[model samples]
Target chain A: MDVIRPGSLQDCLRILKTEHTIPIAGGTDLMVNLALNKISPDRIIDITGLQELKEISLSDNFLKIGALVTFSRLAGKEIAQYPCCNALREAAEKMGSPQIRNRATIGGNLVTGSSAGDGSVAILALDAQVELTGLDGIRKVPLSLFYSGYHQTAIHSDELLTAVYIPIRPGTSSFQKVGKRNALAIAVASLAIYSYIRDSHFEQIYIAIGSVAPTPIRAVKTDLFLQGQKITSGVIKEAARIIQDEIAPITDIRGTADYRRKLIANLLADQLQQLSESKN
Target chain B: MLSCKINGEEIHSEIPSDMRLIDFLREEMNLTGVKEGCSEGECGACTVLFNGDPVNSCIMLAIQAEGAEITTIEGIAKDGKLSDLQQAFIDHGAVQCGFCTPGMILAAQALLDKNPHPAEAEIRHAISGNLCRCTGYQAIVDAILAVSQRK
Candidate 1:
């Protein structure tokens, strides 16, 4: 096997264009895949030296995140306290142990496209967009349509995900994951909610769930049903039922499909009730 | 070739592109403190301080350590003396099987270095990656708190 440490983002793109090389960022996911023989690349491009792709900044009402930024940075003091980063921060803080978080990058998690990835589940609710760069040019794709299937994404083999952008919107966002244990446990089901309450009613709602489908998906039917609806116990019940009914959760060792539906319905109801009672 | 500072010493070595940092440290460098529990990131027995932050070396390539400052269990001592944190573990009976001691000490050291004083929850969170099946963790937490109280 051969590895080339590209000095810059331009160099990485150039290498990707001419060679069948896989890019390695944090290597938190890629290394595992390599060890499992899931993917064996003759040439691997180490992009860790590309310092330009390791920034997190707020620009034009969007929280722009570089693809190489690690989970530890996301859960740092400043981002954790940032109002626009609530859901993302929460997900980072809860996703993995310190050792893993210190090395795992947000881009690796999204590119891995795990159905139960906590970080991706939270980003899905934030209504984010990702910038993929290639020799041809750069393309910005909304994350909602980025995933084509389980562990599958629209990122071309020749393209590198350069950065991620999350629009800073008004109101609050939250994330929670249910699993057998906290550390080193994959989520049985996870939920992320972003919403605004106006005059005791729901204005805009984005509900994203993970480990309950082929990919982390937004609850389209549930979101449409809850828009402009008053927050009440009856409404919460209906919303829970809709989310539980619409998702296609699977039965695995972590949890049964039926158990996942029941747990997620309860999770959605709990989050809605919190939003209803919050002073925001 | 990887050129970096290890335990305050400048070092250079030739390694394969796919060679893991843990393998290099143990086999090539003869620093056996970095243990491999689960080759995956789930188990933190191979935890090492990459620029003072705890990271599992098993999942990281030696190529990634280019110009990086790494601290393994061997680096925790000062002037051939075990640091106060290591002594605290012994005094508090925090070690039984000793498999997880090095990683736990490094993880705790990272937290205490940052905070100088950490709450019980923070201590727990710091070593959450290093799993200790020998001690029930009460003693380990006590050992860390003992070190913290000294400051």
Candidate 2:
């Protein structure tokens, strides 16, 4: 395979538009595919050279993270300072390993569309939007609506995921994942919650789940149920019940369908319990 | 052609840039110290320093390192003297079959370069990527901690 290191974003877009070349960043997932003979491309465009997509900036309380920003940066101390970044940062910390995090990119994670991907699920809970840049122009897609099916995304072959925009809101967020082991294990199930809790009641809440569906999904019913509800053990249990039915987990090597459903409920309860206890 | 620095030496190669960084450093440049136990990234046997950060060289393209500095196992010793890390690995019995020693040392080196004095947990977390089939991680962690303690 031939590799083209595009000097500019526009140049990369032009090549992607004109040729059947595949765009690669980090190459963590793509390399695995290559090793397994899953994808054999004639030409590959290394978009890592596009420096514009490697920055993280905040303006007007909205954080724009470049697509090439590795997980190491997202989970690093610098990003942990952002109040709205807690969930994303937590997810980055739980992802793969130090070596894998050093190379994996948020853009690559979204495009790979693993239901259990740390970055995607965490960003989903934060109600983030992905920026897709193509030869025509750039358009934003709500991360919730980005995935079409298992291992599939809305990104066109000619388009590249340039950046992710996260709305910075004042709240506490947390992410949890159940894997075989603490490090270097794919998630059996994971959950992330972002909320503004006052007097043990949720003012606003967003919940997202992964590894239980074909795509990482927003826990809409559970979120709506928990919103404005008093944070008690009873309410937490009810929300857990609501989420078990809302998610569509499968029996995979990582976990059984029943086990995943059980995990979601427990994860939700554990996170909500923390908030309730903190109020005491 | 790709121009870059490997093990403190400036070099250029016209070989296909699509080759894995591990293959480029080993087959093309003869830097076999960058092991390739698992072509996939699951095993840390192919870890190397990419611009000072440890990464799975097996998963990276040689073209990706066109202008970046790379450090492999060969880069650890300077002027034929064993780096402190290498000496610690030996003193602590961190080596067994030795297949994982190179990757382990490089991964530990990257961690030390970033945080010279790492806690035991930090040392374990840093080397979590590099797995020694010998399952002698306690010694490896001890060796890394010893080096950190010495400094």
Candidate 3:
């Protein structure tokens, strides 16, 4: 196997456009698969050295996180202290362990396209936009449309994920994960909720779930049911029922399909009740 | 060929591009103090200080450390004398099987480097990745707390 360390983003783009290589940022996930012989790419492009992808800046309309920003940075006080990005911070802090977080990048986590990824679930709830850059140009795709299937994404072979843009919206957000252990365990089922409540009603809401589907997905039916609805136990219970039907979970080593369905419904109901009480 | 500062020494060698950092440390540099229990990032047995931050070396390519400073278990002691944290490990009987000691100490060291006087919860959080099946973690936690209190 050959490895190429590109010094700049332009150089990386050029290499990515011309070569048959796998771009490795943190290598927390990729290296594991490589060692297990699950993937055998002939060339590997080390993208961790790209300075442009290591930034986290708040713009007027969005909080732009660079692609190579490690989970440790997101879990740190610098990013976690931000009210708008707190759910994402919670997800980052709960993933793996300190060592894994230090080497795991948000970009890598999304690109892996794992349904068990906590970061992807939170990003989906945030209604974030992914920035993909190639030799031709750049395109921003919504997180909802980014996943095509299990372990597959809309990212092209020649394009590099440049940044993730999360809208700067004032909302109450929460992240909950049911992993086997507190640290270093893949989530059995996870949910992230971001809601904009006004006058004790849900003005806008987004809910994303993981490990209960082929890919981390938004609970579109549940979100639509809750939008513009009154903050009441009856409405919350109805929305929870809608969420149970929205997911297509599978029985795996982590959890059973029936258990996940029940967990999702209960988790969503609890989060909705909490949000309602707090906002009211 | 890559160049990196290991154990406070600037070393340049022709390491394989595909070699994991843990293998490079143990095989090429003879730094066997960095254990390879899991070979994956889960166990944290291969934990080392990469640019003053603890990371699982087994999951990292040796080429990735080209320009970074790496500190393995061998780097913690100075001039054949164990650091205060390492001495405390022995004093508290934190090394039962001794396999997880190096990684635990390095993990704790990374935490202390950032926060010298860490709380008990912080110490446990710092070494959460390094699992010691023998000592049940009380001794390890006590060892780290002792070092912090002494400082």
Candidate 4:
């Protein structure tokens, strides 16, 4: 139950590597896990107070989101710049409740690597990259490769996730999801679709779905099929079928795998129709 | 050891390292307004404003609150005068059993402080964390909105 408040990232890594430490950002997830007796670490590194880790900036090619940036901060009008990211914004807006969003962080959500994490699916759809800092220095990794499996991440105990980078995409995006209820609810099945249109045809399509797989997964088969294809009911149905086949949903308290598959098909078709209608 | 400001008073207590903020406020400070509905983060009954941000005190460690300013329901009124928001809650009949009111008030206060002119949707979003089984939340939202609409 040791609580260590390191003044800098370097010091944090030093103390973390020297002991059985867990970095706590917002403590939205870590606190709950600790209370449930699920995780026991000798030292808890409090990173929530680190000012350097709380910044939100944008570069020429990418948007950099600090590891400690709360969902409430990201939901601000300033950071929500792109259309696909709009879905991410909407998801952020619906995460937990206002209190939860104020404390729960983007880094915590990504680090938890839960398939049901609403923000995880949204960021995954944006093709975000994560920055890691340690004794060696800073290095970045694509977010897709960050999570190795359920409740697991490539992030080591000696490293700290500093920022998340999202490259700007050209297109309008929408997120449609079905949860048990409205607020503080995990998605039974959710879909994020970002498609760029060129002369009524999809030049590029980015689709990811969550709560239906071990991790938030992109509908790669559907994405490839939709690319360069005209928006039509037939194309949407075909892509929907491809998504149902691609994702490996499991039976959880939320819903059954068969139900989730059906949900994916319906949500994909609905969002694609919405994209088509919004075009005019 | 935890040292921080709670309810406008500087606190320095050698509490158990694993004591959560909710327990610290209730047992040490005797500020029982922060009720614990769910020990987990799902229920917002134990919500408190830490550094002007609404968070679940139940899920956070007491030591994690060190060096931070916390606002509880007891801190809402000054000089024995109930805040307009608190009065509005009474006026709108927002409390039934009165367990969730303190947290509800703090959550509403945090929202009003940030956005004084929040829309209806925003009002709902602000108190989404605080669960109210008695009022069904319409009265709660009305109370917050009524107070916010006042000047």
In candidate 3, stretches whose alpha carbon ends up further than 4 angstroms from where it belongs are none
Q: Evaluate candidate 4 and give its CAPRI docking class based on DockQ.
A: medium
Give the CAPRI class of candidate 3. high
For candidate 4, list the clashing residue pairs, or say none: none
Clashing pairs in 3: none
Could you give the DockQ of candidate 2?
0.86
lDDT of 1 by residue, B66-130 (tens): 99999999999989999999999999999998999988999999999899889999988888898
Per-residue lDDT of A207 in model 3:
93
Is candidate 1 or 3 superior in DockQ? Answer: 3
TM-score (chain B) of candidate 2? 0.97
Looking at candidate 4 chain A, the ten consecutive residues that score lowest on lDDT are A78-87
Output the lDDT of residue A129, model 2: 92
After superposing candidate 2 on the true structure, give the runs of residues whose Cα lies further than 4 Å from its correct spot: none
Better of 2 and 4 by TM-score: 2
lDDT digits (tens) for residues A180-223 of candidate 4: 88888889998887778989999888888889878888888888
Tell me the tens digit of each residue's lDDT in model 3 across B25-141.
999999999999888888888999999999999999999998899999999989899999999999999999899999999999999999999999999889989888898899999
The candidate scoring highest on DockQ is 3
Q: List clashing residue pairs in candidate 1.
A: none
Ranking by DockQ: 3, 1, 2, 4
Candidate 4 regions with alpha-carbon error over 4 angstroms = B1-3
Ranking by TM-score: 2, 1, 3, 4
Candidate 2 scores a C-alpha RMSD against the true structure in Å of 1.1
Evaluated at residue B119, the lDDT of candidate 4 is: 91
